[model samples]
Target: MPSCLTCIARKVKCDAPDSLSDCGNCRRLGEECRRHNPVPMVVSRQESKQFTRAGTKRRRSQISCLDCRKHKRKCNGELPCARCIRMKRECEYDTSHGKEGTFHHSYSVQAPVLSSIQTSPSQTSHTSSSAAGYQSGSVNSPYFQSDTSTQDLDPLAMFAKQCPLFPEKELMKSLVQQFFARIAPCRLFGFLHEPTFMMKIDQGYGGRFDEFLLLAAICAAATKVNHEANKQMWESGVEWARYVLQQLILDLNRISVTKLMTLVVLHEHEYRIGNQSSCFLITGLCTRYTHILQLNVEYDNDILCQNSSLTASEKESRRRLMWCCYVMDSFASSGVTHLQLIQENKIEIQLPMSDEHFLFERAIVTDLTPDTIDHRAYLVRLMSIRNRILNYVKRFDKDRDLWDPQSEYHSLLSSLQEWCNIIPENWNLNHTTIYARKSQGLLSPLIELWIFFHLCYLDLYRVVVPGLSPAMRPEIDAVQIAAPTDFLQSSQEACFNHAVKLTRLLEASIQHEKDGPLDDPNIIIGAHEAIRALVSYAKVASSRINDDTKQLLAELVDISVHHLRLTQKRIPTAILGLRRTVSIIKNSGLAYLNYTNLESDSDSDSSQERPGLEEQLNPLSQFSVAARGLSERHGKGTSSARVGSECSSSQKSMFDDDNLLSPGRDMFPTSLEGWLTSNQFGDFI
Candidate 1:
C-alpha cells in the first residue's frame, strides 16, 4: 500500500524504492521527492495555513500588481514586479487600507488640463493629496491627507472632465453643499416642511464619481457661518450629513465603514487608552443610523417615508445598504475587541494582532505584539465561521423576498436554529494557556438575538391580531415559541427573556454619547419604541414557561427592569405610579387606568367624552375578546398603520376598532404584540 505522492500527482510510475529520499522516478526526473508522507483526507479547516506549510510554498505569480487579480496569472505580489515594471504599472496592495482607500487615485500625469477655471469639490478638505501630505503619526488621525488648500484642488475640476459621473463639476459641488442643509439644521420635531438630506443622498450621487468628498472637506473645515446656525450634531439631520460618507457604507461589502472600522482596529493603540475623538465619530455614526432608521420606520404618514421618494430600484438599494451596515457593525465591533483586549492584558503586548482577532484585528494586535506561534487554530476558527456566515448569506440571497420579517423571515430562523446547534462555543484566543480562556463574545450574540426577535414577531403574530388583517401573508414555516405559556418551561424562560432585553438595551445605547446629554425626541422615540416593544414582548413571552424556566426568567426580569428605569422617559417616570395597575393588569386580567381623575372632571365636556359609539358597539370588551382570541381571528387585509400619528381621511387605522397599545378591547388581539403571537404561531419563530 506504500505510495509516492510526487509520481501519483504527476500520473507517473512510482518506480523508486519507498525510502524517505530515494524515489526512483523523482531521481530519474531530477526532482527531490524522497518523502511520501500521508496527508489527512479532511483538513480541520482551522489549520488551513499549516497544511500549506507542510507542502511547498506557493510560487509567486510572475505578475505583480493590483490589476493582476483580474488577469489570469500568478502574482509575484511584487512592488512593481517585472511584469508591472515592464508594463509601467504601479504595484498596488489589496489591503483596503480602511477609509483612506476611496480617495486614492492613480492619475496619469499627462492628461490634458481643462481649458477653463477649474472647480473644487465642496468637500475639498478630504482630498487624498492633503491626506498624503500629512506626516505619518504627525496628525493623530489614522487617515493621512495633503496639507493643500481647497483652492488648489484643481484635480476635482479635471476630475469632472475625465470622469463619467462628474460632468459639470461646479454644479455638482453646489448641489452636494446644498444637500448638507437638510442634515445640518438644529432639532428635528418629527415633521419637517423642508427637504431632507436623505432626499439629496438618495438622489444626487447615485452614480457620481465622488467629486463631493473635496467639497465635504471644505464644508467641514469652514466655520459654521451659514451652515444652518451651527447646530449640535445630535440636534438634527446634521448627524446624517456628518456620516453621509456612510451612504457609501450601506452596501453589502461597504469598503468605507469597513475601512474606518479597519483603521480603528488597526490603530487601536493610538486611540485605545482614550481615543475620544474617534470614539465620538463612531458614536455619531451609530447614533445617526439609529435615529435615521427609527425615523424611516416610524414615518407611515410623514413626508419622511423611507427612501420612497426615490425610484423603486433606489429604494431597494437603500434598504439593502442600511441593513448591511447594521449587520456588519456586529463583526466590526468584534474586531474592535481585539484592541480592547490589549489594554486588558496584564503583560506587555508585542503583536500586530491578538492571534485571536479578525484579519482586520490582526492589522492592529500583530503590529503591537512580537511574532510568536503560527496562530493556525485561530485562523481556522475564523475561516470556518466565515464559511458558515457565507452559507447563511447565500440562503438569504436565494430568498431575498422572504428575508424580511413581514415576509416569511421566520422560515429563515430555522437556519439560525441550525446555526445555534452548530456554532462553536470555544476558541483559541491567545497563545498562553493561562490567559486563553475559551469564549466568543459580542458578535454571535447580537446576530442571534435580533434574528430570534424578528422571527417571534413576524411569523407567529401575523394572523391573530383582531382588528387588522394583512392583505397578504408571505409563506413561511411557523416556530413553536409562542406566548401561550404552554410552550416553554419556567426554568429556561430567562434565557429567552435575557436575550431579548439585551438586544433592546444595545439598540438604545447604540449611539450613546459620553459627553453629550441625551434628549433628542427622535433618539428618545427610538429608545422608547424599542424598549416598549421588548418590554411588552417580555410580558407576553412569559406565558411560554414551565417551572424549570423560573430562575432564568427571574434573572431576565431583573435585568430588563434595571435597564428599563435607566432611560430618560418622562412617560415611564410618570407612569411609575401605575406599577400596581400594570402588575394587576398583567396577572389578574384587568386593563389598568385611573379614571377617578376623569370622574372628578366629569363637569368638563371633553373629560366626559368617551370613545364614540359606532353603528355597532360590541357590548363585550377585553375579557370576551381574550377568550375567543379575537371577534374575528382571520385578517381583514394586509394591515399596517403608522403609530402615534393622525391618519389621513382615506386611510383607515389598522387597529381603529380598538386602541392596540392600550389593554381595552380596542387594544385586544390586533395589538401589535397580540398580532405577532396569534398570527405567527409563536415559539420564537
Candidate 2:
C-alpha cells in the first residue's frame, strides 16, 4: 500500500514504505506528506513482499498503455491492479502464456493509471451507500435530534402500559429476565487490564468517530456497575460521573443530559473485562471529556488542525470520547474493579483515537405545557425509582420502614434523588432542561424506574422483613447517630406525594382514553389498565397487605408487562417495562438474602469468619447483643458523638457502626434527629 500522493504521481506501481509518514515515494515526490489514515499506524511490509516474491516471474510482459505500464514491468500479468480494472481504465489483464498456453507469473504489479486512481470512485466506496448502518450518520456521530411536542396523549394515559412495580417479590422475577434474556452469558461482562496483555496492542479500530460511540457506551456501563453495589459511595459515584461528563460536554464543545446517562451506562458494561483494547479506548475518552470540561473557556481550542474538515487534534479528541463509550459498555457487570486489575496483574490502558463526536440532541430536547397525563406519568417513574431506592435502604433499615437515613439505603436514596433531580420541577416537561422534562411525562418516570430496579440488583440485601432485627430497639438509644433529617425525609415525603398524585392522574387519563377507541393497539392498552395497576400501589401504601392488594399488584405488573411486550413502542417505554420485570426478579433475590440472615448460620466457623459486618449483624444474630448495647447506653449518661475515634478510622474493621451505639432508652430516638442515628457511621449514604 502506498500513500495516495505517492501512488498518484508515479508512472509505476508505487510501493510506498509501510509507514504513514515519510513513505519512500514521498521523498521522491519532494512534497510535504501525511498518513492516509490520519493516525500513525503500522503496516506489514515484510509479509507483503513475501507473497510477491513467492510467485514466479513472467518471461515476457504484454504491452499496455504508457500510463498503466511501468519500466521493467512484464506484461501477461495485468498492467494494473484489479482496482484499476473496475474503474474502466485501459490496462493489460493477461499474464504471459507458456508454449502449451500455461500462464506465466509475476511478483510485481504494473504501474497504475494516474488519472483513474486519483479521479475514479472505488467500488468499496460505492457499495457502502447501499448498506444500512454501515454508512449511517450516527455510526460515527454522537448527537441525535430532538423535538418539542405536546400534541400526543398525556403520559399518564399510558400508565397501564407500564408494568412490574411495587414490592420486592415481583421485582426480582422481572430483573432476571431482563439481564439474562437475549444476552450471552459471562461474555456480556468481563475485566481487562492492558498491562496484563501478552502482546503489543492494536491501536486502530476504524476512526476516532467509531471510538467515540464505543467510549460513550463504556462510560454508561461503568456507571451501571457502580450502581449495582450492595453499598456504594453514591455521592462520590454521582460526583465522579458528573465530573467526567461535565468535562466531556466542554471537551466536545457541547452538552446534553441524554448522552451523559448514555455514557454512564456504557462505561460500566461487563463485556470489557479482560479486554485490553477496550480499556485503552476509555482512557482516551476521559482525556477528551476532561479537556472540554476542565479547560477555561478562553483557552478552549476549537481548532486542532486546519487541513482536514475536522481538525486532527479534534478528530483524536472524538476518538477518545468514543473509546470511553466502548469501555463503559464493555465493563458493565464485568465484575472487574480497579482493585481487581491490580490483583490480576493487568496493564493500564489508554485510548488511541476514535475520530468520533458528541451528540445528545434527544435528552436535551424539551417542551413546555406537558398535559396532565404526562405530568402524572413522570411522577410515576420518579416515584417508582424512589421506591426502588427505598427498597435498598430498607435492606439496612433494621426497621421495615420505607428508608433509613443512616443505613446503606441512603446510598441508593441519594442516587435516586440525584437522578430524578435531573428532571425540572415544572408542569410542562418538553421544555424543561432536566431528563424528566424532555421525556413527555410518561416516558421519564418509566425509564427512571427501570434504572431504580437496576440499582436494587446491586445491593445484595435479602431482607423481606427488617423489623425482625433487634438492632432497631423498641425505642432508640441516645448513642446511635440518627440519619440526617433534611435529606431522606424530605426526599421520601416528596416522592410519596408525587407518586400518589401521579397514580391518580394516570387513572384519570386511562379512563379518558377508554372513553374512545383508537387505531394504535397501544391506545387500547392506554385504557384503565394503568389505573387499575396504580390502585394496587395505593393498597400497599395504606398497609392493606391482604390477598386482594397482593393480587392487584400482580395484576398491575402483569398488565404493564403485557402491554409493553405487545405494543410497538419506543426504547424508553421498553426500558421501563423491562426494568419493572427485572425489579420483580431482583426483589426475590433480596428476600433470599434476608431470609438467610434471619435463619441460623449452620457453621460456627462461618459465623466467626464473617468477612463483613453485614453478615455478622444480620437479623439472625443474637438479639441479646443489641439488648446489651441498648442497656449499655442507659449506663453512659453522656451521648456518643457521630464521628468515630481517630484510631478506629485508620484501622480496617468488619463493619464499623460506632455511630450506632445506644445512649439509653430514656433518650430514645423517635424521629431521626430526636432519637436513633448511627453515631460512628460517617455519611450513611
Candidate 3:
C-alpha cells in the first residue's frame, strides 16, 4: 500500500502496510487517492467536434442579452444583439454564478428602455408600436390612463353585482339609521352630517367610491356594536372597503375630507376587530391627511367669512374634524413612545355645537347655552384643559423651588371639580334614574369622563407627592404644620386615595355586561393608569401606607381580570394588554409582597420564606404564554406594547385624559428602561 497524493502534499505518512487496500489517510478523510490511474479516455475526431458544438449552444443560451427579455424578442447570440444595435440601447448578460451554478442579476438597476409596458398586446405590433404612446406624450397627460390591473378589478362593480345577494335597500336604510342613532351620537369622530348624509343616501350614493367606503366602514362598526347584521356581512363590508381604499390611495392628490373620514372609520373598524398594528398604521395615514387638509387650522369668524368658498356650517364641520383628529390621536399615542399629532394652543376654533344644531345645519345659535351643548363639546373642552396641564407638567423641574402645590396641583384639581360641578344635575352620577333612558348611550362616555377625571388627579399628584427621589423640599417650612392646615400632605394622600377609588369606579361601571364602561378603549386605558399609579405608590410608600394600598391593588387586579373575562369574546386584545401589563408588574416583585406583614417578619425567616420575583410572577407569565399559544393557533396577533406607569414627566401615564399629557415633549422611556433592565422584564417583553 502506498501513500495518497493528499497525504504526500501535506507531508504526512499514510499507513496501510498490513494489507493491500485503500490507504489509512484516504479512508479516514474520505478522499479519493487518484494516485494510480486505472484507465484513459479515448475519443474520435468526429465525436470531439460534436461535443464542441453542443457546448457552444449551451453557453449561448446562458449568455443571452437583456434586450431580448425586455422587448420579448429573440437574441442573435451576439454581445451587442442586432436589436440593441438598431435601438441604440445597452445589452447586458449576467455572468456571475455561485458554486451551485445559480445566476444572480442586477438587471432592474439598468435604465428601462420602455417607460411602460403593456402586459398583453397583439403580436402584429408588439414592440414597434408600443413605444408610440410614450413618444406622443400620452404618458405625460394629466388625464388618468386606464390601468389594466385596476380596470379588471373594480370593487364597486363587484359590490353592485353582489348587492342583491345581501339584504337590499331595507338593510342599507336600517344600517344608516343605526349609525346615526348609536355611532354618530357617540361622536366618535366628525365624518358626516345627518341631513347631508341622509340626502346623499336618498340620491343613491352607492356609486361614489368615497361615500361607499365610508358607508362600509360605518356599517361594519355599527354591526359590531349593535349586532343587527350577520358577522359575514360586516366582514364582507370591511373587505370591500379595504379594497376600494387601497385603489383610491394611489391618487394621494385627490384625497378629500370624505376620503379622510372614510380612513378614520376604517381605522375604527380595524381597531374594533382587534387589529392593533394595522389600526395604528391607518390612523398614522389619517393624521397625515388631516395635516395636509390643514384641518388643524382654527378658522375663526373673520377667517370663515374671508373664505367665501366655506359656509359657516362647513367651518363648523372642519372644527369638528380637527377636534376628532385630536381626540383619536391622543387616544392611540397614550402610554406608548409615539408622539401626539395635534396641539391644543394652536387650535383656536370654537367647540362643536350641540349634535342637534350641527346635524340639522342650523344657520344660527340664538339661545344656545353651555348646558345645552353636546356631550362631545364637553370632551373637547376637557381635553383642551388637560393639554395645558400636560404642558405645565412637562416644563416642571422637580428641583425648582417655583413648584407651588396649592396653585399648580390644587388648581388642576379645582378645574376638574368645576367641570364636574357645572354639568347638568341629570348628568350627575347620582341621578341614575335620569340616565335610564339613554343609559347605554351615555354610560360609555360618562364612565370614561369620570375615569379620566380621577386619573388626572392621580397623574398630577403621583409626580408631586411622596416626591420622586431628587425632588427639592417645599419652600413653605414655616406654614402651620398639621392641625388641618397641611393641604400639601392632604394632596399627597389624595393621589393614593384616588388610585384606590378609580379602580372601584371602574369595577362598578363594568357591572352591566352589555353596556359596560370597560368596553370603551379609553376606559380600559384608564384601568391601566389606575394600576400604574397604584404600583408606583406601593413601590414609593412607607410600609404602613403600602399595607393599606396592597389590598386595593389586589382588588383592582381582580376587577380587571374579571372584566376582561366578560369582554374577551368581544375584545380579545384588551385581555392581551391586561396580561402584558400585569406580567410587567409581577416581574417588579411589588405584586407578591404582603405589605401588612412585611415589617413584622423576622429578617432570617423572610429570607427563607419569600419567593423570588420570577417565582411570584409565574402565574401571569404562564397565563400570557398560554394565551399567546392560543392566539397563534387561531391566527390572531396581540399587541406588542403594554401600558405602564408614568416612569417620567416626559413619558405619559396610560391614565392621562389625552395623549397630549406632555405637550411640546417627545417621550423617552428612561424610567421604563431602567425599571425593566433592573427587573429583567426585557426577557418577558
lDDT of 1 by residue, 1-685 (tens): 3556666656667766545555776666555563545454435422342233324223434323456666755565433334443453333433343665433222111112211111223222333212211111100111112222322344544333433233254444444443233221211100111132234334332211222332332233222222223333112222222332332233213222222222222112111112223333453354244333341232122222233333222222222223222322322222222111111122122211222232111222122122421222222223233323322321332443432444433444454454344333332111332123212212222222333333333222323221111111122112223323332233123333434554443333332322111211112222222333333434545465445444443344333343333332311221221232223224322122212321111111221122221101111111111222223433332232222123343234434433334454343335667656664422332
| lDDT (10s digit) by residue, model 3, range 227-288 | 22266665665665555455345435455676677677776666665666565567678788
Cα lDDT, model 2, residue 36: 46
Lowest summed lDDT window (length 10), candidate 3: 130-139
lDDT of 2: 0.29
Q: What's the candidate order when arranged by decreasing lDDT?
A: 3, 1, 2
TM-score of 2: 0.28
When sorted by TM-score, best at the front, the candidate numbers are 3, 2, 1
Query: What's the TM-score of every candidate structure?
Result: 0.27, 0.28, 0.56
Worst 10 residues of 1 by lDDT: 132-141
lDDT by residue (1-685, candidate 2, tens digit) is 5445434434445555565556555467464444343322323432232222212122233243333454433333332333234443333222333554422111111122110111111122221221111221111111211111211222211111111121132332232222222111111121111121111112211211222232323333332321223223222333333333433333343332223323433333321121223333443453344344431121123333333443333333333333333333222212212211111112121223111111110111112223212232333334334344423432343543434555554455475556455544453223232334223222323332333233232222222221212133322221123435454334333433343333333333233322211112212222222322233233324443456644544444444444434331211223322333333333333221112212211331232222222222321112212222232232221212122223244322212333233344322234556333543333332
Give candidates' CA RMSD values in order.
27.9, 22.0, 19.9
